[model samples]
Target: MCGITGFVDFTPASEEREVLIDTMTATMHRRGPDDQRTWLDRHVALGVRRLSVVDLVGGVQPMVAQRPGEPPVTLAYTGEVFNCDELRAELRSHGHTFTTSSDTEVVLASYLQWGAACAERLLGMFAFAVWDGRTDEVHLIRDRFGIYPMYYTEVPGGFVFGSALMALLKHPAVEPVVDTEGLRAIVDFVKAPENGIFAGVKEVRGGTIVRFGRNGLSVTTYWAPPARPHEDDLDTTVGTVRELLEDSVRRQLHSDVPLGVFLSGGLDSSALLALAARHNGGETLRTYSIDFAGHDKNFTPDEVRSTPDYPFVARMVEHLGTDHTRVVVSPEELMDPEVRREVLLARDIPTSLGDLDTSYLLLARRFRQDCTVALGGEGADELFGGYHWFLEDRFVDAQALPWLEFGRQMAGKNGLRNTGLINQDLVESLGSDEAERDLYATEVAKIERLPGESDVDRKIRTVTYLNLTGYLRIILDRKDRIGMAVSLEGRVPFLDHRLVEYVYNVPWAMKSFDGREKSLLRAAVRDLLPPSVLYRKKAGYPPIDDPGYDRALRAMVTELLADGSAPIQPFLDLGTAKSYLADPTSAASREKVNRFSLEMVLYLNEWLATYDARLAI
Candidate 1:
């Protein structure tokens, strides 16, 4: 794994070039502490900070490939390509000679043969910028799932790209201002929309790439999840999903350093731990779990004594004899100003408020002590038939319908909020029906619109696929930032396209079985996990019980309200901000700091204040 940054401009000044690359690469010190490199030129400058994972002694960057007499292809990459062996074999047959067994080399070889299009063929979590000195062009690409994030900003004369927003911020040319529209996206509870945190900054949007050449810049899609037919039966689908997951796990297991998995006592992470246990062959696979010190009440629904996954975590750890570390963090720690600030700094952008984010911080902070690379069970629910609301709610009842009463309820519920920091933003996002409309349009564009098909089926396909595009992106990207912030490389076995493809084709009934969700998954490897853990109702990642996370968030908002330096203060009234946070449950209140809505305001406030951002275009 590594941190990459560079600039592609009409021309370059040596001082400006060095300063920009230095700023970008230094921001990711934790991500790649071992070594650093740079390739500077008149028009293109690339820098890399690397953590030696695969090529312990050999993997270095910016890596270049020249076949005896060809102009070089220089690459700075972040993330792992799980299918490097397969790519190597394919490239070998195509007359490529490798200098290293590293995936970076495989990528360079792919570029040698396929040129910029090599990105489309890669199967891994990655974001890379390949500078082809020969063509005097730069190609930037992100993985299909966006497992690795790539953020970039376009200035008057050039475009700057980096693995972290902080890197881009290091360059004086690139402003670190927060994007108000981005705040609106979050306040609308449409967090993680196409927009990123910084105003002028944006993301590559997974499954897409950008090619910067003399002809100027062009962006295009190189890959997307297939929305097509299933040629397999239930039994075959189950078996295939199982096999693919194992293969993905096997590939992720390739690391020069010792590796481990974060055991959250959830289906996703547990499944990985089970497979990893088998892979380790009785060797202690180091494991980490995040537990709240005082908020044990978070799991009260399952009966503290009876929660299947919790006991099962211990069981699995014992079964594998892992050097298990259960890190217990406090509600106080979760809200600690310094810890939170450290995390936000690493985020390169503000994260949504409350437990989901902080719980990850608890785990990732603990992970820093044990292993640099850890596997976690993520992406299964999206790829497979999971999520309580999706299974039991109107999403299915309305016949796979797009926004049923449930989605409308969500919009209405959020609409009812007082909207303190982002009342204006919330209203603006609601005004634009584009995001939801786009989902509907996407469904119609992809699915068959025959005369007789039930709207329910269409709705099911629509919400599931739309979520596959949207909600899934939010969570997976969240996992990426949270994990990487601690300089930890997290691998998701469930995101393996081979496995996701199998689950996508399997009927919901097979996966859920008798009105269940993820049943097919449970049945596939019943022997791997204990029956108690196998049948446990999905609780997902442990959440912080500080429901008042928003209250603390409000403190930040109040500070911003008094601090004129904040961009949105001019647009907001003090009464509106207080009302939104003080009494959100009431329709008459202003800020409406519920879990999701409050998060938006907190995100916006932190972003604006942190970066000294402005709102006006």
Candidate 2:
């Protein structure tokens, strides 16, 4: 919902330091175009770019609270604490009077009341910094789901933290250095916790607090998916899941600004729309969906995406009688250089899925024109065993992470991105396969299995954990980065900590009780949705099937071949790159490997030049 950047300097503060903080905040201008402000003290400097979602006129920051005798507590926060009204009431009862009707003040008072443990009592997707002038320390907290991103780097005097990696890179104290581990992380697609992809930088893990001050930094994990025994029957579990979901949707709908729901007509999105509509009562419900220009006419089934989204979206729109708008993107828009660059800027890294990432950015930007907040259906697949890999026998039995196994399957079919495209020497040096193996093992070891669990149950639980902890982060990060790029606040009720925890411990058997994906979710909201939508096979966000997009990508990558000094040349195998680009008119779904390879080459070259990145390896 907003962008936050700040620093704590153990050394003396100078005019240059203040300017650096300003520059850092400036990088996230698009994230918070509504307003900008800065706060400075002897050792701490905080900045915020606000989007003005709730209490728009009142919740301006960096908000500083000073009690009669206590040091001023300054807060630079990003995100809507969905439970603000309740928290404000409780804090008010405890003698905390609010001057502004804003959640930001409630958060500051919460810190004043509970100290570092304040993070434990909050609910919502947020990444914030609470500067306690009393203790001369700052507490950095990310939500339980890590929905909002917070990256930090330790500098000479103290540290620099920001909402995006680019925000941190804007400071002169940081450099674009990718070490071997960072490269491995980029290639492997396994989002290891706190793996920031740059040397000397780390992300604050979800449900954790990082305390930094003159004493140095300490991290404490306040929440995680607890491995608990299943204590309820199928019906009770279903009822409980439905109850939690309704509560989450009701809470998330507490937005003062105009809001909408993304309607893909998939189970997750439809259910969210249904629940949100119910919460809206008789009020008008605005909805939006995205699709390619000729998607329905040119639809092609694939392992990842089977059907087009437009038809299903139409059904939901008509069924719900909601005001709906469909944004149909053409191939040219998908291949536009400026648009692609903005997408790359949103995510300060070479994204793995090129069109998937850029399309959402474009759609979010369009949606921002009408509304500031949009509730989306993410985290459901991971939480409810909705991915196809969860049902595949090979992946279910594979000792590795199921998603990794799925990637291997894609590679075997010559469909995986970057397959047969990268330099073999780089692969050997990074040892990506081995690194991935180790990472999978580390993640698996973290899953605490229940006593007397069956082997089948154990394997399913492991896959569930991997998806929630690993794959879920990647999706959520994309959602946050792209959504914030346009100042669009994206809320995911499926990711509410309580819901995730409850479904996490439910046995996979019940999750797929009807021999279908997301059976539990389908059953929970069956009455609210049409059968066509309620039982529709899951489909991913559709990719542009137009061959023109592939041709455009090839033209861009071919230019790289002519320019031998291209930044990505050192990382590419010239022969393979040339071979892939020879016939570049096939759609990505038909020729995934070649299309993705060319897209990656262009993105990699641009990313290197954009950041002037250095490869230590």
lDDT of each: 0.70, 0.84
Top-scoring candidate (TM-score): 2
Residue 94, candidate 2: Cα error in Å is: 2.4
lDDT of 1 by residue, 191-295 (tens): 343466667777787778887777777888876555555667777877887888888887788887878888867667778888887777567788988776655
Question: What lDDT score goes with residue 107 in model 1?
Answer: 87
Count clashing pairs, candidate 2: 0
lDDT of 2: 0.84
lDDT of 2 at 278: 92
> What TM-score would every model get versus the actual structure?
0.88, 0.96
lDDT of 1 at 364: 85
What's model 2's lDDT at 79? 84
Q: Which stretches of candidate 1 lie over 4 Å from their true place?
A: 12-14, 177-180, 189-194, 297-309, 396-421, 424-435, 439-457, 546-568, 571-573, 576-591, 595-603
